[model samples]
Target: MKLYGIKNCDTVRKAKKWLEANNIEHTFVDFRVDGLTQADIEAWLEHTSWETLFNKRSTSFRGLTDEQKADIDQAKAIALMLEHPTLIKRPVLAMADGVMVGFKEADYQGALL
Candidate 1:
């Protein structure tokens, strides 16, 4: 499994700690450092919707121009997220079967523990 997110993200940090404590071996990919590819995003989209992966409430998204934020479809959202990795949600875990965006202790326990 691989966790895709920024090092500074609180949610990502919590997720990492939980994974380590539970002895769930995984790799962490920092979006700002390691980066991501279109193919990577596409693979995640196969299991989840763009709406789930795209972080509309993020500072990166809020800082966008009104026009850029308006009438966003999957294609546009994907492009925006690619242009600004911060626009993608935190702690995007890519497991063998699917992707999980964000961190929830209960959810993590349910899926991982």
Candidate 2:
């Protein structure tokens, strides 16, 4: 399993802590430092829509120009996320079976535990 997010993000920290507490083995990829590939995003897209993965409320998204934010499609969203990974939601958990876009304790319990 792999978890992708910014290292300093609170949500990511929580997810990492939970995984460690539960003894779930996972590789963490820090988006800001480790980087992401289009294939990684594409693999995640198989389980969830770009709309779900795109974090509209993030500071990175909010910082975008109106022109960049307007008329967003899947391709546009993916491009934005590639350019600014912070625009993607926190703690994206990638497993062999599925990909999860965010951390919810209940959801993690249902899926992981």
Best by lDDT: 2
Q: Write the per-residue lDDT of candidate 1 for residues 5-96, one digit (tens) a residue.
A: 99989999999999999999999999889988999899999999999999989899889999999999999988998999999998899999
The residue-level lDDT of candidate 1 at 86 comes to: 94
Clashes of each: 0, 0
Task: Score every model by TM-score.
Answer: 0.97, 0.98
TM-score of 1: 0.97
TM-score of 2: 0.98
Worst 10 residues of 1 by lDDT: 53-62
Candidate 2, residues 48-104, lDDT tens digits: the string is 999999999998888999999999999999999999999998889999999988999
Whole-model lDDT per candidate: 0.93, 0.94
* Structure candidate 2, residue pairs in collision: none
What ranges in model 1 sit over 4 Å off? none
